[model samples]
Target chain A: MNQSRNRLVFLALILLGIGFVALVRSTVNEYILSIINFVGIYIILAVSLNITNGFTGLFSLGHPGFMAIGGYVTAILTFPVSRKSMFLELPQWLANLEMPFFPASIIGGVCAAMMALVVGLPVLRLRGHYLAVATLGFLIIVQVLITNWDSVTRGPLGLNGLPAITNLWYVYPWVVVTVYVAWKIKFSSYGRSMLSIREDDMAAQCLGVNLFRTRVAALVIGAFFAGIAGGLWAHLVTAITPTSFSLILAFYIVVMVVVGGAGSISGAFIAAIIFSVLTEIFRPLEENLDVYGIGEIFTAAILILILIYRPQGLFGSREPGFLLTRDTQ
Target chain B: MASSNSVLLKVEGLEKRFGGIIALADYDVEIRPGELVGLIGPNGAGKTTVFNLLSGVLKPNQGRIVFNGQDITRLRPDQNAALGIARTFQNIRIFKELSVIDNVKVAFHIRMGHGFWKTLMHTSDYRYSENEMEQKSHEILELFDLEAIKDQPAKNLPYGIQRRVEIARAMATMPKLLLLDEPSAGLNTGETDELVKTLRKIHDTYGLTIFIVEHDMKLIMTICQRIQVIDRGRMLSTGTPEDVRHDQRVIEAYLGKSGHGKQYAQG
Candidate 1:
């Protein structure tokens, strides 16, 4: 009872923090609310990806590919009828189309999840290097498809004039719910089995874990959330481009999980926020100092520093509830 | 306990080949209920391969596996597990990164009754299941004398204790049959003796039907009620420990007619 109460108090504290931030945004003309919104989206993506990559021990390099599918689908589906009407080069069917925002967003997420399942069925059966290469190849294939497909994706020209619908209201609640779901999973038996599989697949298999089913479950789940994050990103930016969800995005998500601590869900949460803030704080520098790909250089340097210094990001594998002695399970 | 004279596991003309070499060929054995059966063979005798096939890790290009009187040839490994068959590895295989208790809890996952929503909601059923698994894992660990180290990471335990924990984790699932591969391997004489005692106690106490692959003949002779001797993947003979000890065919299979197999066995 005390532990459950502690969890409640912690949840209250997190809500308090988010409320304080939103209050501050409403009170002051601060420029960082957008950064926090980005952090929430990345947190959703990072925590979701960690479910598969960290917990299930599946090296999924196609996260950005799935995210891209979600972003593009949601962006196109939620494109206001006015904008759709304006694009003459677009198909007559698309120009006359109108998709309600929320349902379109969820459909976008489901599309991405379905893509994950379709790809995962064959790709996830492999192990180690083979799995990595297969996912990486899938990412490249998706990117190429998005770039070359002119009718729906608008080719390299990309889609623009999307509604900026993600605000403090949408992001905070979504982040909380996603983290809570992930926390529940981490403590649940499915989570335990997934973690055991991470530790040793052969051992887990002997203990009644179906490897294919487990991996697919984790993959579909993680991809579903990543897709949701993509929906948020598509609306928040008011533009959709293939380049946004690319290999570089994949690398960043990996950094969020690795620097956070592969086995730690909260680690991903904290690291995503920190990394997202750092990227924004350094954005001007990145734009001006594009000297020899300074953005990659800066990210690589931060990653190296984290690896050499903190090792397990801010939270490690210890959950916030455990830090407060709330729940043991 | 005598194996009810009723077959639990049957292998017939089972063969495994790796490219140019045949690892197991024309192997057959039957394990019955409530029997402490020993599978003993030389290093290259394909004893482990037989275990692998029975456990459904490797598919025989052709063969049928019937468990609990149900044909399960096409069943996956987890399906085999659900049907009350559990196995340990020849080399220690545990979820080394997890706590010992958590390792056992993982084995009890199929017992979960709650859906994803219940888990997500942290419902009463979810909490009950989690606590039940933890308590049961603790109880089983205690039974194996592993309670003190339940919080310890599995890899940190000593080899003998790790083996015991593996069996304990397997038993946590309440399997009808247990397969232990080299459970006594890498143990000192003292550890092996304790292992034999533990095995005998578990068999007598729980009435567990166990099939073990061990090179430790002393432990086998002391505890296993029956021994199956195999050479070149074919069963040389199956009998009581004493009967197999005197069988000339078993002697020649292990001794290669050098006339020193019995002396080697006495250690």
Candidate 2:
């Protein structure tokens, strides 16, 4: 009871932080708010995907595909029912609809998870690089279909003029929930089973782990979160192209997970924030400096250096709780 | 291990073949409750094959394995494990990347009832199970004198200690039937002696029906209550250690009638 109470107190503190952010509307500028929102979205996607790829040892590269499902689904639902002129390529059924934000977002997430269940069958059968390639193909297939499917989606022209509904209030609560869930998994027995599978599949199976079931559960749960992140992105940016959720975006999310520490949940969050900040700092240099491709070149270089120097990433497999190092003992 | 009347495992006509190589043609053994059975033979004596078949690693061509009075022939490997069959490999197969604590934690997985939802939610069920696994793993590690290296990655441990860690891992499953393949292999004499003592301690404390495959005659002779000798995929004889020591067929099986087995007897 005492431990539960202490944990509840800790969660209250986290919720207070989110509430505090919600109140500081005048002091925080839109530019800083944008960066905060971006970090939240990245953290959600990276940490959620880490649950599967890192902890469960399922190399899924189709996270962007799930996000695409969320983005398209949410965009379809929340578009203004009277705004037909805004969607030239949208079908009559979707253009004539307008649903509230929260329900639409959740439904979007649900659809993405269902799509994951469909894809996970053949994809999870392949291990290591084969599974990765198969999932990458799913991402490409999603992107190409979004670009060409003129009826429901806007096709290559893309969905536009989505309502900007995600504020700091909208994002930080979701972050707390997602991080709470991921961290819990890391310290739990199920988490240990997943880690065991990552270390040795045959041994884990011999120990009574249902290999296929665990992998699919991890993948589907991760996809649900990815979808939720996509819905948040759609509302925050108010527009999305098939190109936004691309293979490159997938690479960036994976980089965040890796540099944060692949198997570390809290590390994923830290890596997301650090990478999001670095991208923002480099945004202007890569944009107006006429340096052309040097910006991406440097980013790739830093990733290579990280892999060589600290392949386990900043935290390795350790979490933020052991940041003081003394607690590690 | 239960009372002697419990009848833990009964194997009859367990046969295996590897593309015309007959590993075990007609293997029969009855492991009673709480009995320590020694499996001995010359090189390629099909001892390991028996261990593999019982532990569900290798399926026999023809056999009936009545485990706990249940016919588990076509069960999944983990299902066999859930029925209280745990094994250690001849070549050590520890989870190399996991810490010594986690190596045992993985073994207690089936005993943990927490699911993905429970884990992700940090429910009481998850916390209780995790704490139980940690305490059990720590205790098992201490038994093998591995408490000092409990936090160390498994691969970093020395080879001999690694083997002890392997046995500790198998025991963490709380198995009713523990199959060990060459537990004394590669251990120095002092280590082998300690290994024998540890095996005895485990049998006494946990009461697991242990079936061990060992090449060391001295170790098996000292540790086992009953010795079963197998030669060329056939059982030579099985009896009390004193009876096996005097059995002529068992002598021919081990010393080849030219007579290393007789050398021990006549001397």
Candidate 3:
């Protein structure tokens, strides 16, 4: 009976969130609404990255690469059929193909997941700095491919003026899904294995946790969500370039996961919102003060301070007590 | 000696080398079901190497490991564990950030055979399995006398309890063969005595076959039905405690020539 009440309360809370999104969508100014959308996108990215870098203890810089793949796939599939033929020469079947944003986004995510499986098979073998470098290499390779694939990607200048369909409704549901899935996995046996791998992989393997499979699964799952976030981001801005998914974006996402708490889902979600809001607030302030790179400096300083004082991030590897109410199961 | 079919673990002519150095050579061990065997060696007699080979951490350069009538020589660590061979490390490797119960719960990974979608969906299958996991984890904690401190982070525990947690985690795997690499390495006499009792209780209760490597002569002599002594990566003697204590070579290589032998005799 008590559990049923908790579930009812949880459902009411979710409905309240949806209503809140609707209220903001109607009442908020365009600038603030854009910021909210950005928050939702970052939540997806940070939470997804946590699966690989935080939970599985892999140091990957390939998130932006997966995002790029997702964004391009969604854009191409959802592009106006008339616009598709005018901008660049796509293959015959792809040229005529037009899809809805939802299915296109899913396809983008699937493509990214497929790429992760291929890349992770070999790259996941490396650990520590080597793994980081290998993933960074993957990011670079992705950028280079997008830049050089002139006919398909239109060279360095990427697909532009995509339909602006990414609103709070779309971004909000994805945000909820990403967090919900990550939360579920985090609290399950699979999540325990991921945590064990992060703590001591050799020990995890000795206990019958398949190290390779678990690590790759983390990467693939993270990549899939990253792909979706990319599609959302591309539509929100209505533009995407090969240079858009740069090392800086990768670094920022890593900072969010690290600052929030690696293994804590709520930590990543909260950190994403905090950092996104901070960056937006700093942007106008920096422009008024004419201080270029001040935002980067501030975030870096915060990161360093966090490392020195509280190396485990805000929540460490645990959730807050309120969020852990149903933990008895 | 036991027939091949009766043995739970059969190792034959196991050999390993690190570059030019021979860490283990021509080692053989046969552990029958329900037997508690001990491996004793000096500091660098490759006792850990044997554990590594058996647990599939290191692929033996030359050997065959047959577990339950199937050859497991080329299996990976996780595969060996799934096949009912679980091991504890010489250095405690419990997940320090996790609670004591969570540490033990990690060992149930292989047995919790559910799909990722089920895990993510929180379906009835997931709820049922998670409940089962919680109950089993609690039972293990109770067996190890850790039920009271199950919620405490493993890192905050005393050294002896951390050791016990590692053993308890290994027990959660429900393996037919348990490879314990120095269970009483850093324990005091009292703690070692307590661990000996725990080992005996679990072995008799579950009919577990345990193969332990330890430097503690008293712990091994008191609990192990058969003990194998190695020197310079080769098997020196295998027999009852009394036979190994009286062997002239064991005295010279391990227990020391005369005075140390007397000290061992006193035990």
Candidate 4:
């Protein structure tokens, strides 16, 4: 009885949130709207990354590689056929093809998920710092590939003038979807398997959680959403570059998940928004002072402080009391 | 059911080695269904090696293991679990940060039977199985007298309760054979006594086969119907607890003194 009531209340809250997004879309200036769009994308990235790093305890840094795949795929599919033909050479079918944003975004995500499956099969065997390094290597490999594939990616120059179809309406729904799916997985049997693997993998195996299969599943699922975020990001910026999805962006997403509390969805949500807004707020200030990377330096300092004092992340793997509809623990 | 006389688990000429050192050699065991058996040995006696082989934690450089008439010598630990073998570690390994109930519910993963998409979509099967898991996990927790602290994280519980929770989690797997490795390792005398009751009650109530490794001689003698002794990786003796207690070799190799058996017997 109480569960149904909570569901009703949650539905109302979601409706109100969408209405608020619509209000901001109409009232806010372009600069503020862009920051809000960035927040939505970061929320997608941080919450999805939490599945692999937070729940499964697989310290991966390859999120940007998956994002790059999604971004490039979506950009290619959605690029105007006239622009595609004029900018670079392509195969007859792909050069002639132009798609709208929605299906192109989904295909980009699917492509990313497929790549994760291929990489995860062997790399997921590693653990801890070794896994982290392996994933970082993957990200670097992706960058080099994009840089060298001149025919398809236009080398270091990258593709530009992508249609700006990514707005609050497009990004916000994906944000809601990513967080909802992550929350559902967190409370499901698969979530339990992932958590058990994190705690003690040997014990999880003895109790019948297929260790390799669950690890790969977490990575694949996380990669799919990252791909979608990449699509949204490529469209929002109206351009794509090989260096755009860099190690810096990867580290920023990791920081959000870590400082938000790795295993807590609400924590990731709050952290992503706070860090995104803070970075945006610091950007103009850094420009005015002619100092570079002030935003990054400030984020690093805050990360260190959180590590020293709140090592479990801000929420310690549980939601705060107000977010609790039931006993999550 | 396989006939009552048929062996539930059969091991023949099992051997394991680490570099130049031998962990076990020519080790053999045959356990009929529903037996309460104990493996007792000194430190470095390869007692755990035997459990490791049986549970598929380590591949044997050796012989065959047949459980319920299927060869399981080469199966992995997860496969062994799916085949109805469950075990607890000598070092307690409950999911420390998870609630006690979640620890038990995790064991039901194999039997939950719903796939990823069903869970994501919150299909009817997902909700039904989840409800079933919650009720069943609570029932198992109640069996171990852990219901009062079900909501508390496993790490916050006393060592005794944590130990019981490990066993409770194993039982939730609904294993046909349960292997316990030094279950009394960190328990005090009072806690050990409580565990003795719990093990016996589980064995009696469920008719489940139990194989235990123990340094606690009282736990072995008080509860185990049959005992197997190993010293330096070879079987020293196997018999009823009373018969094995008086064996001369067991006293010298295991008890280390003739008086030790009498002390444990009286205790």
lDDT of 1 by residue, B1-267 (tens): 444777877766778887767778877667788878999988888898887888888877666667767877767778888888899998888888787888888999976635466788778888898888878887888888988877777778889888888888889778888999989888999998888888888898889899999888788888888899888867788899998888888878877886797766654
Top-DockQ candidate index: 4
Summarize candidate 3's per-residue lDDT along A1-329 as a digit string, tens digits: 25576566557867988999999988989999999999999999999999999999999999999999999999999999999998888899999999999999999999999999999999999999999999999999999999999887887888998999999999989988998888778878999899999999999999999999999999999999999999999999999999999999999999999999989888998999999999998999999999888878888899999999999999888877645555432
Q: After superposing candidate 2, which stretches have Cα over 4 Å from the reference?
A: A1-25, A84-97, A321-329, B1-6, B15-25, B41-49, B58-62, B125-127, B134-142, B228-267
Per-residue lDDT tens digits of candidate 1, residues A76-114? 878877866555256777667778767777887899999
Under CAPRI classification, how is model 3 graded? Answer: medium
Worst 10 residues of 4 chain A by lDDT: A320-329
Cα displacement (angstroms), candidate 3, residue A38, comes to 0.5
Interface Cα RMSD per model, in Å?
1.7, 1.8, 1.6, 1.1
TM-score of chain A of each: 0.91, 0.92, 0.97, 0.98
Candidate 2 on A63-108: residue-level lDDT in tens? 9999999988988888887765455555566667788888898899
lDDT of each: 0.82, 0.82, 0.91, 0.91
Error of 1 at A180 (Å): 0.9
TM-score of each: 0.94, 0.87, 0.97, 0.97
lDDT of 3 by residue, B29-67 (tens): 988988999999888999999999999999999989999
Q: What is the TM-score of candidate 1?
A: 0.94
For candidate 4, what is the DockQ? 0.77
User: Compared to the true structure, candidate 4 yields what TM-score?
Assistant: 0.97
